[model samples]
Target: MTTPADVHGVREPGLPGRLLTVERDALVPLLRGRAEEDFTLPVAACPGWSVRDVLAHCSSAFTRVLEGRFEQGVFSPACNDRDIAERAEWSNQRVVDELERGMTEAGPVIAKAGGVLDILALGEWVHAGDVREAFGEPGAYAGAGLPSALSLMAYVTCRKGHLSLHADLDDADEPLRLGDISGRRPPARYIGDGPTLVRLYAGRPVDGASYELAGAEAGELNIFDE
Candidate 1:
């Protein structure tokens, strides 16, 4: 694979904030308009989590970020379960309301934390995809925020020291260089659309999508340990 044309493009200071805002505008209304039954739908990407569970987890994380109350093992399974459990008695609208507020307010806190918390924005964006997939709505990972999301992802992947890959996306104006910034190894090759590439990075289910990868294993590309 050739070297990517843009590898350092995701280091924008306000990117995390912009991503959160875009997602809030897109996701909050959908959550508000949905029926109560829709909140109970299972998210195939996030096993054992329904739509409400995912929303609760997302909102709780944002709440933590907004409130500056991160526990030692924050975002871990037990921590997430506790966060969701604490909100179990609230109505779905309340959960969504909190999520909307968190999405709007947490971005500035994340921005001020320097680069340490940049990945939280990416996770929030991907979790939005999980919610969309569960609701069977299109554009799960690809949307208005996709450009910012991809930029943040590039930064996150590089920061986390994942393997580098040169992606040739059908919808992109140009190829993307993601993962290791030092270019210690020859970057792998990826031919696909943006959403499928996201699926690969997030380690989410990719049963039916079509894509080609070379010089790197799919398992090695996952930025999230979980």
Candidate 2:
């Protein structure tokens, strides 16, 4: 794995920018390294996939994006078993090699496209958060990447048929308030602890891990992928 840059890549649009580079250099290696493990540990949020499975899925996702194989808006069934299994035979180096080549190849193609920068920006930011969340590092994306990641995730999840939820949170433990606005309110008001909240919305139960949803009812909202 290449050494991480002192400052993560340029958070710009299109390819060859700082953000994508940081994503390639820092995030991919972290993900690939973990993929080589047995992950006997439980990834409660993912239901079935072990840590390795999540990595494999992510690798395929990056591959798709880099190969110009994406749908217009958002995907209904966000991901399926096919994505998970594709990486099953992959080693860390293999995944990294594929990602490096894909991103490099897609660089020019993205540069010529309209609003491609936004796409690249949003993709890396969101996936970075995904790897962070899957590994239980909820605060990993707590930098300049947070706002874009949160906004894009909320928008995409909504587009994919999930409710536009913004949970009210305060200093209290086990707090679970669902809405779209960010600020003070009734039962509680959410602090800007974004990544974990995003995970909760994605149907990944961060409860007792990164968050606590007091009195939260199951299926209160359909938090599944479209």
Poorly placed runs, candidate 1 (over 4 Å)? 1-10
Off by over 4 Å in 2: 1-21, 32-35, 38-41, 68-79, 100-144, 154-192, 208-224
Per-model clash counts, in order, read 0, 13
Tens-place lDDT per residue, model 2, 25-134, is 66655655564453434455557766555555555655665666666532223453766665667665775666666544555555555433344445545545555666
* lDDT (Cα atoms) of all candidates against the true structure: 0.87, 0.48
**For model 1, how many clashes?**
0
Worst 10 residues of 1 by lDDT: 1-10
Q: What is the TM-score of each candidate against the true structure?
A: 0.95, 0.53
TM-score quality measure for candidate 1: 0.95
By summed lDDT, the worst window of 10 consecutive residues in model 2 runs over 1-10
